[model samples]
Target: MSNYQNFPPANEDGAASTQMFRAFVDEPAAQPPTAPNEGRRTGVIALSVIIALVVVAGVVYLAMK
Candidate 1:
């Protein structure tokens, strides 16, 4: 009754079209983290840590008031 349970069109022989329709199921991807990208990510992480420390120090100073 629902859309999920709706039957596909039938052929003249009464066979459902769904039998001919194959879902394009993909296999698991294989994109490993590359060294170049990892290097860039490490640089970003280092920069973020430095900026976070600066922000925390500033917040502590402001909160001290």
Candidate 2:
């Protein structure tokens, strides 16, 4: 016998309760709107490019030593 069962109390057979339950279940769930991160992404890309450029310069300087 499976223990995972959800049988709501059979004693709760009121008309008002039934209507309230139906109304609750009929509504769509709300979702938060997503914000664009274009500026942040550009900033991160610029930082990565700067870091890569610095690493290449360091490597060239060491190689010339």
Candidate 3:
């Protein structure tokens, strides 16, 4: 069996092994950063507002006829 599977590698001289361990453990976890959907969201909102206004105007025109 591999030695590291049983125990952490020795840091006998307090140098290389320790640096390697720190580099492995202290490294930040990889993450997929969230992206802002500002443009798409704004376009969707504008389209919804226009659709609502058109529907309201159509209803008003039908009621006035």
Report the lDDT tens digits of candidate 2 across residue range 5-65.
Answer: 8666787654568778888999888888765887899999999999999999999999999
> Considering only N, C-alpha and C atoms within 3 Å, which residue pairs clash in candidate 1?
none
Candidate 1: stretches off by over 4 Å: 1-34
**Tens-digit lDDT track for model 1 on 1-65?**
65667554564434535434433234456797667687789999999999999999999999998
- TM-score-sorted candidate list, best first: 3, 2, 1
Q: Which has the better TM-score: candidate 2, or candidate 3?
A: 3
For candidate 2, what is the lDDT?
A: 0.87
Error of 3 at 28 (Å): 15
Backbone Cα, N, C clashes tallied per candidate: 0, 0, 0
Which of candidates 1 and 2 is the stronger one according to TM-score? 2
lDDT of each: 0.72, 0.87, 0.84
Between candidates 1 and 3, the TM-score winner = 3
